[model samples]
Target: MFLGYHILTKFFKNGELSNDSPKESYLYYEKNAIDGDLQGIIQKLDYLKELGIDLIYLGPIFKSKTTHGYDITNYFSISENISSNSEEEAKAIFAKLIENAHKRGIKVIIDLVLNHASKEFDFDSVPKNLSVKTESPRSPQEERWQMSFLFWNLDDEDTREFLIRVGEYWLKNFELDGFRLDHALGLPLNFLEEFSIRMKKIKKDVTILGEVWEDEGDKLKNFNLLKKFKGNDAQRFTSMFDFATYDTIKEVLGKKNGSLLELYNQIVLSNQLNEKEFQLTYFIENHDLPRFIDICQDIETFYITLGLLMALTGNVMLEYGNEIALKGDQTIHNFHESGRVAMKFKEDWSEQEKKTFNYCKNLVDLRKVHSSLSSGSYELINSEENLLIFKKKTTYDEIKVLIYTGEQAYQLDKEYFDLISNNKVLKLKRGIYYLQ
Candidate 1:
């Protein structure tokens, strides 16, 4: 039942946009770190524990030209603008940050952008086997604003050895818990296997999460793509973030045409509970997608989706600004700024923001106390009209979840305990209810 939190390191503070570069060097300026003074994340460690997070997943921190460090120029050094320190000083600061996180019982994993590097990378440092190769970009709108990246030659042995050492370096030097491999879809199976093996060898319990989804394709999911990451007990990725199910959740919001059954079925078929070799991590929002509240439109409906997401039988991650319903929209012109907004704290929260934060905190706390909600197995009990019911159970503990996402009044079959309100009731409508 533990929760994971994702933080876009640069835009993590409230006044982040104010730190944009004074003199533009590229198509767009840096968001929070261009000769800037925004405080580093290590100072805000207490904020994570207050939200019931057990693991912290960070966006890229490597040296790069853009605000988002996905196009890394140097894997060995920490980004210069993130702090006021020199290159070597920043690495030492990062290592100490990991030590403090371990003391607080929070595991830390970072994004590993293996597919490409900033064209600014010094190529002479590596072997002569590599060459300059530029492929067509993925998202068309951000092309002009984005930095030109040099695609890696996965077929080359020297390239494989070079990238793998990058993964091993962080684990060995910083005692990092794991990595979330960015853009991991349809990678050569052999390279993926070798990469996973090399990472765990540095730390046996390292978690390697893959971004294996094709939302541009369809909701049915590409088992052909996912099968590449699924492996045996000896060597395999620890889990995958469930973008397919999140797509379905988006459909059910605001009395939409979609049904929760599609989401349920997607999970059951994704990696059946009996198959322990792989697992899925479900999230309502992330740095890439639009904010959950922005999509829900109604405050109550936003809470309903948040409740439904947390109730699923898998791991969950809460992006940094999501606790207070932060807003961002991806588009052709400003795609990165769309979702990677600065985080808000308690001192300056609106009533709706406070409610959303508490509602999320309550759902997280419920999972901690209820065993069935955490490690228990899942089964569909009922789905009639707007009401869909499911059960989570172990041999001794059992809990049932009732959700009403349709418009108009709904009736309860029996007296039920509303986990959200902490009260018993016999009538319910358009909300989430968990009963023992």
Candidate 2:
């Protein structure tokens, strides 16, 4: 089968990697930046629990040189940069956080950066025969490609086995649930198959999510390629983040000029791959993209996007600040001003902001309570210029979603319960609403 209806995932980065926290900055990779400590994450477990987050896809925590731990220096150690603690203490604290997260019913998964390593990564640790070093290939993600990474030679059996052991080390050592393969596209399909075969043997239900991106025309082609990652007896990835769909959503909601019908059409296109065969993950913002509020430039549009994300049929992920509507100007090339905005604790928000954030809670709860919103089939009941009415229905449940970007009022043919405020209504206006 696939993920349960109640599963809600999140992209978690601890601390404010902004100029506001300057002392923790990396010497070479970033300036005017500071990193959040693992200790600080322990205090936020309750917040994630309250938000109904079932799984958290954490940023890289391996020993690294930057605020975002993608360029790992060591595979077996926690980054001392994240916390002032020694590596041992930092790792202990991380383990404690995972332990606590599991206790609160939240599974934890960190980025698995197997494609490359820091320029500073000690090649001495690698076998001489396996050290077929090469620069990271030219990529659309120029910032990463420009940074000069030491790419792994996956063709070498010793290298693949080394990486496999690295993944296994995390699973066997930490109580970690699984990993988000950093650049699954960079790894060979056979390697992914083998990695899955091994990782699953350690934790049968381990969640291995991949980050695979392809162009619009290649969307279905990418889906078919993802299918190859699985063998007849074992599966490779539980889900993958589809950047094509993410880009379409970003264009429509962010620029506020893209077609609503086109947006819905993208979801319908992606729905073809859903269920037992392939699962896609959707989000409003992540560490890599510009924030919803910043790009949309309108709070109302941001709210509408959030509702659509929750109501859609697929896996759901909330970037660190998305639940409270943190705005950022983060680009693929940089992250100083926006992407690294620090966590806003519950006490940090004003009553109105807190109330608005709780509205996010209600939205997630709606997904969990209604299989129709999560696992059900999606159908467009009606549509117009900037307004669309859709329904998600399964054998046991059904829910209607009304999302409007226009000011026009719409007439309803039947009364239904307002799933958000738990009220009843027979009419609708310019807003996002979920009903049963």
Candidate 3:
């Protein structure tokens, strides 16, 4: 029952500029060096602890052209401009981070973008003259193999083999606790199954979470599409990002259909994944979407939304820059890097933002204290126009009943204490009860 953040630069760096290219270049430089300034990150360790993040998932610190380095250029190297990019220096910083995080009882997971390398990476440095050959429908054999990527020619066995080796190299070298794989659906199924098997041998308890944005059940039915990871295929990678829930929310919101209650049904129904699928990475937004605050509009509702995710069943997650209410524009153009704005901690947070932040902290606290939310079975007890009743029950003693209020506030039994507010018992039978 831990909350997670994708990027932690805020804890280490200072004065992140918001302007375009200069900021991007500055980010590149800061990331390449290890000494940029990590006090900001250090100071926030306790803050994350307060929020109950037993783990934090750093997106990518490897060297790359963009500020948010998803496109990994050097798998073995840290970004040079970042103060600790030198091998020794980077290891030292990583050691300290691991030690500090462990002391706080937090686990660290690094994002592995094994699906593709940045087109900007100096491919010439590699042993082979491997590069994208042509961008057309038909090209020479060598040319096509060089350029084949996630969306295109990776169908080649040699290219897939190279990618698989890259994954294995990281597992053996870095000793990473776990990996949050990027665009897992695009990967060759056989490769994923094999990679997961080899990586697990290195660390028995290592957790692997796949970012499979495809429709699990439907897609898998079409010739096993390397989609669903089940049975022997079950890599240590146990969970998946719940894009299904996010999509449903968008649909519900657009049609202005069913209350928040209906939304909850959609979530629980979607989550009825195969038993092998152990966890669900739940979130309203991430590096790819508009900020949760911007989407919800009402800050209070945002807090309630977070409470639902945290308090409901399964493993939940919060993005790296999500805690401070970081907002970014979502567009098809330059959409990749532009989605992740520098995290603002000192000033941009609104009062409502603080309230939502506190709510997240409290909800995380409740989840850990109440294990039923984590390991228990979830049931959708009731569903109406705007209100849905869901219950989480564990083996022994805990039972959490969730009431999701959509656009309108509904009434619930006054006996239940509002978890957000300390255990102050309420007496009113029904009065605008949204999320409690």
Candidate 4:
């Protein structure tokens, strides 16, 4: 069952508040963008609602030194860059933003970097030996050094209590729906279990999404690691970002002579391994990865790849401006600065961009209307050299998705309604086709 399903149903009558929308998608916003402030984001709630977005994963709003907001100095205070006023005023603005978003039926999940903090964080109570010096290799010539930033000594009772308090304070005070835990794999399993337990206690319907960018087989590896942290126990995290799926999609869609069979195998394997109740957050591009448009080289391939992502069984997440073909590449020197550029709106868009946006909006709408596309069992109908066909079926509905990456158009045997065009399509072309 989806987390917060019952509570959301009880609160909202129209079934819009539930997180189980097949179109449940996320948009990652950077704080430094042109219209990235809390007020600016509130002003654009209608844009997101119109795009069929169900959730907004705002990048860290806490006090931080870097533009990315990962190196947080104060977890309790909102960043001065995101809010130029007093801390209390900033909190008020954020609360108002949340109020507006909830009113529009869009959930908000803020980023929480629990693995590490900035060197400037006050750590006087913790022992000096707990501090660790770390360096991130930027390039062949340079490295960024981080000194005395503690990853929170999990063994210490005081540290765990403080962190739990932080989690509870935000959930209770801000009325937040959930949190996106950054670098979650780096944190100890014990800390995760306890943190999740405590946070859920405060708000039972609150969701927790962890950043676990390892192979699908690493769930067993994580299980083993948790055993080492303590004895055998159940995994507590609700879901994690599916990096394995992202990598397979990139390999097939981004490269020439990429195999459709390999991509099909990865999709099947991921479904087999993932837990039924725990959904994997799926995305083609994020702040850490290069844009799909930059790697795919052609718009047709990009749209086909996006269609495949939307058809997968999980919570779909799209980085900001991906629908309009925002292009950027992350480098060791610039880090993710290039990938985290400002978002473009209607007046700043081109003809091609508008087309891509409409295509994405159509896909999102199709997902929302069909139950099979959102939460259903998957079955592979056919897998040819350059063409792939699959079906997602629920008891009530079934959706068939076809993808042809070859040069020539492909023909179909039966007539079906094209979800993209909302017209009866008799044959398949050298593009993506969806039938319900």
Best by TM-score: 1
Task: Assess every candidate by TM-score.
Answer: 0.89, 0.87, 0.78, 0.82
- Give me the runs in candidate 2 sitting further than 4 Å from their true place: 1-25, 29-34, 127-146, 214-234, 329-337
Root-mean-square deviation of every model = 3.4, 4.2, 5.8, 8.5
- The TM-score between candidate 2 and the true structure equals 0.87
Question: Which regions in candidate 1 have their CA more than 4 angstroms from the true location?
Answer: 14-27, 30-39, 124-147, 222-224, 271-274, 329-337
lDDT of each: 0.71, 0.71, 0.57, 0.68
After TM-score superposition, the amount by which residue 358's alpha carbon in candidate 1 deviates from its true location, in angstroms, is 1.2
Which digits, one per residue and each the tens of the lDDT, describe model 1 over residues 1-436?
Answer: 3479988776675223333444455433554332322245676777777888889898888877777777787888777666434766777767776777787889999999887778788666454565434455444422552457766767777777888888988888888999998877635678889998888778887888888776564555545455546666325578877766676777766336577676667756753622454567778887766677767777777777777777776678888877777766434234335666556778888898888888888899988777677667889999876788889887877878888876777767677777767999777767888875
lDDT of 4 by residue, 300-351 (tens): 8899987887777768888877778876644424534556566677888999
Tell me the deviation in Å of residue 305 in model 1: 1.3
What digit string (tens of lDDT, one per residue) describes model 3 on residues 143-217?
332442323246655555555565666666654567888867656567777777777778776778777664323
Higher-ranked by lDDT: 1 or 3: 1
Q: lDDT score of model 3?
A: 0.57
Best to worst by lDDT, what's the order?
1, 2, 4, 3
Best by the lDDT measure: 1
